[model samples]
Target: MAPRLLLVEDDLHSRTAITLFLGDAGYAVDPCPDFASALRHLQNAQNDVPDYAAVLTDYNLGHRDLTGLSVCQAMRRTSNRKAPIIASSSEMKYWEEVADVFKLNLVPKLRHQWDGPAILAKLEEIGIKP
Candidate 1:
């Protein structure tokens, strides 16, 4: 079976694009549009463990209070804690915060660069083959 991935992106265009990209690259992506949905998926454990191989989230989740970093932190507390969490955002400011403090991987989302090469590379770097 293809590896499963959790994708949390608020922007519709980004979500669709990334989902399609990863799907084409042989991953089953569960795309979530907001923080709540992502958490719900993470908490919905199967056999007491979430089946996600990795998670990719945006920094700015369109919420004034919560960001993707919040999602990453939450994932660490879930049954899928060992799965890799990747923070993807055009907002360079929070990259260090996520990487340094939380030790999450980052894929810098450059505008008009939503193609999946960087993401795929990051996944490979972190030992996720897909």
Candidate 2:
């Protein structure tokens, strides 16, 4: 089966672009607009363990109380810590230390120069690929 991924982003355009891009790259993506919904999706998987090969979440999810970092932390706390969790944001450097603490991968926001190759490289760095 194609690798399944959880994609969380609040921006409609960015969300659509990433969903299409990853889907075209052959992943079965479960798209969510916020951390709460994404967490629910992760927690309520058919298997006790989520079947996702990886998770890609935007650093900011509107003005919510939680961010992608929170999602990564929760996943690590409840699920597999080794699974790849990537955070995307133009200001990713601001959260680099946090991501490092959680062992989450960091990728630039896709709206800029962060194209397919860039994301692919980040995924590969985290030991995930299309």
- State which candidate has the highest TM-score: 1
lDDT tens digits, residue span 1-130, model 1: 8888999999999899999999998888999999999998998854465479998888889998888888888888887787888877777678676487777787788783454899999888888875
Provide the lowest-lDDT 10-residue window in model 2: 109-118
lDDT of each: 0.83, 0.75
Over 4 Å off, model 2: 46-50, 110-114
Q: Residue 20 error for model 2, in Å?
A: 0.7
After TM-score superposition, the amount by which residue 42's alpha carbon in candidate 1 deviates from its true location, in angstroms, is 0.3
Cα deviation at 77, candidate 1, in Å, is 1.2
- Model 2, range 25-84, lDDT digits (tens) per residue? 777788899988888877866347456888888878885579887788777755545668
Superposition error at 59 for model 2 (Å)? 0.8
All candidates: TM-score: 0.91, 0.85
Error of 2 at 82 (Å): 2.5
